[model samples]
Target: MKTKLLIIHSSDELYGSDRILLQVVQALRDTYRITVWLPVDHQDGKHQLYRMLQERAVEVQHMDMPILRRALLTPKGLVRMARLAPQVARKLRSSGADQVYLMTSACLLLAPLARLAGRKKTTLHIQEPWGPREAMLLRQLAKFTQQRIAISQTVARSTGFAADQLSVVHNAVPRLDPANPPKPLELDADCARGPRYLVASRWVRHKGHGTLLKAWSMAGCPGTLYVLGSAPDSANRIDVRGMVAEFVSDTASVKIIGQVANPQDWFDSVDALVLPTDTVEGCGLVALEAFRHGKAAIVSDSGGPAEVVDNGVDGWIFTAGDVPELARIFDRCTASSLAAMGEAGLRKYEEKYTPERFDENMRAEMPGALLGS
Candidate 1:
């Protein structure tokens, strides 16, 4: 019989981290008897991840677990966590699994609880770069997990995991079907004629929507900038539409394509992707998505995206949050240039960021105990 593994995840959305969680299950499903626990189901009916897992015949359960969020840091939240601790501990103890895997840093709070519940072979996957204050607290909590897996070197360093305990596995996405070409987006004649760029990410403050708008305006709105994705129901949300209104005089130059089920369709239509994150991005899975679709990226030198792109080769890397420098890059990029860069990016994607490569790396790096060694 395969070793039983319990995977606890914080969210149920089909975003970057959530996709990686599904990929993790795909990588280990044959080797392990896996049961995934999500903290809650999405009320918005966006249950893509859950459905995908079910399609693979993986058992998934939803429960109210202690997930670390900004709201959970307060005095009231602490009281709630204290209240929930015993209940969560009891659940962990009752889970008849040989190993426990905490899917994201948001699930870090469960580390100590898992340990106390006698789950010695607990692993934590650090998918985000941490700020100093949170890193300090997370480091303390991390001590309880026997193994740590970070998606990128930048994330691994930021989370402060020891070399002995940590493994850096870069993220990858499923390859797009070449036969099923994407349909072109409906745009005005003028907008269609010029180079089109895309910025596909959640409307969060740190995602640099403001900076990108500032730079786009400074560059005289050279081409159509398509902003995809909407802000999650969170305190850190940015009024992306309002920011575009405040920055650009020509409303037609910047189009807000808010929240789509298929971002890859847009990825295929655009010349290049621009990820202007002001803070350290965990892995910038969007860049990989763009690359897989044979598209170039203009990413900030904040974290993992910088490592993925070879500046001036496959893609351009500008200093994070430098408006003038980003403007300069925008002004210089022509359709032909972006197309050539995109070709190089496609090669890089095939060589490094394919799903097969990710699965191989994951299987090789997975803890020996989980592999029945």
Candidate 2:
């Protein structure tokens, strides 16, 4: 009989951390029975996470966990978690879970759950930057968790985990075949704009969409910008749309392409990937996605994206939030340079970031008996 594993994931959206968790679950579902507990389910219909996990037949559970939401920082939030911890611990003990895994930082609150169940062999995957406050919050579990998986060197150093306990597992995903890849969506090539650049991420304040817009305008409106990913559903969503519209006031130089099922399919149409992040991101999977698609990236020198991009080798890196530097990069990149850089990036992905590499990583981190028949 295979060992049963219980995973605590932070969000419902299929972002970088979520994608990595899906990859691990997909790989080990055959060797170990897997159950995933998500904080919430996608609104309206389904998010990409639900559909993808269903295809693999992995069991997903949705529960209202206060620690997973914004309320965790409030006074009432601490009271709620203090009251809820024991109940969650009971659920873990009753699940007959052979192993417990924490998939993201938000799931760190569940550290008490594994301990209360007397499961000492818990693994915590740190996907976010661990500063002093974050380290202090998770300090209690530093000695308890059996394994610590860091997505980058920056994260590994920040956590100060013992060398024996730490495993640096970079985020990875399945690559689309380059020969007969997803077809590009044909659009009007009216002499109305220059070459196109794409931004594929959740549209939030921290993503630096506004900075990209400022740089695009400052760069003399070099090319058409295609913004992909889910538009924010916040009260600011309309304001965000208005801001984007204001950026491209007269000409059709910018587009709020909204969300898409497979942004990679749309990638076949754009010039290069642009990620202008203001936060100290853990690992920008967007850079990997771009590389796998034989595309180069213009990433901010913030955190993990820099690790993915070899400065001026496969792509360019500008100081994060420096609109003028971003504008300068946009000014320099042409069709020929983008292709050469993309080919180099593609080589790096094939050499480092494939599914085989992901499987090897899991096998290395997990015990032999659990991952093997």
Candidate 3:
């Protein structure tokens, strides 16, 4: 019988992480039986990956758990996880999976179940650095797991995992289909008085939308700022909306078109992309998305954005949370300069982020390490 590998993830949301996981699964379907476990039915759960898996006849198991929003630290979540651990462990062992792959460090409780299954039958794919308590749990879990794959070098260092124990397998997604037709909404040359700027990110305080708006308004408010992503429905959303409404008084200069099915629809309308996040980021899918669209980016110099931007090569980087520095970049964004950077961005994306490259990487680094051993 072929070896079975179980993928344990907390959620099946339509986010970058989930998308990447789906790509990896699709690539590996010929070799192993891929079973995905999720804690809840995500909003808009009918994602591209979900549909693709169904077509491939892959198994997706959803376990009903009390996963409240922003309740990871609450006692209720901890208790529920404790109760679910044994049941999940028994099922994982009964399925006869050769290895249990835990996708997120947030699955501290689930790690123990994988560990109890056997020392050689577990592995972990960690994306972000964990807190002290979580880190301690990760260390304990790592001892039992056969291998640890870190998404980035920075994240690996921050997690305090043993240098030898962790291997960097940067996240990969399917390359944008160039043969696919561009969105119908074409850009009007007259619409852009200055260089067009695009940003696709969730509306949250730490995402630094306020700073981006402030910088734009301060830089004489030239160019159109196409802000994508839905304004969050949480309390923070109200504050973000108020701030954006106050700063973006001119509808022509700035527009907040909430979430689109495919952001590429508007990507062609922009000259460049920008991400001004203050807090630590995992990896900015928007930056990669911009690259896929052949658009240059100016991202904050922290978190995953910092790692992606080549600082004046394909794109530029600014100080995190520094509105003045962001404004300075805005001042330098001329149409000619942006066009040159866009060309560079496309070159870089083709060179490094292609689906072919990702398949080669996994075949070389992940097969025996993750699924075989």
Top lDDT model: 1
Q: What C-alpha lDDT, on a 0 to 100 scale, does residue 35 get in candidate 3? A: 88
Q: Is candidate 2 or candidate 3 better by TM-score?
A: 3
Q: Judged by lDDT against the true structure, how good is candidate 1? A: 0.87
**234: Cα error in model 3, Å:** 3.4
When 1 and 2 are scored with lDDT, the better candidate is 1
Ranking by TM-score: 1, 3, 2
| Candidate 1 lDDT score at position 186 | 68
Please identify model 1 stretches exceeding 4 Å from their true place: 41-45, 178-181, 186-188, 191-193, 367-373
lDDT for 84 (candidate 3):
67
Q: Which candidate should be chosen as best, given TM-score against the real structure? A: 1
Clashes of each: 0, 0, 0
TM-score of each: 0.94, 0.90, 0.90
The TM-score, computed over Cα atoms with residue i paired to residue i, of candidate 1 is 0.94
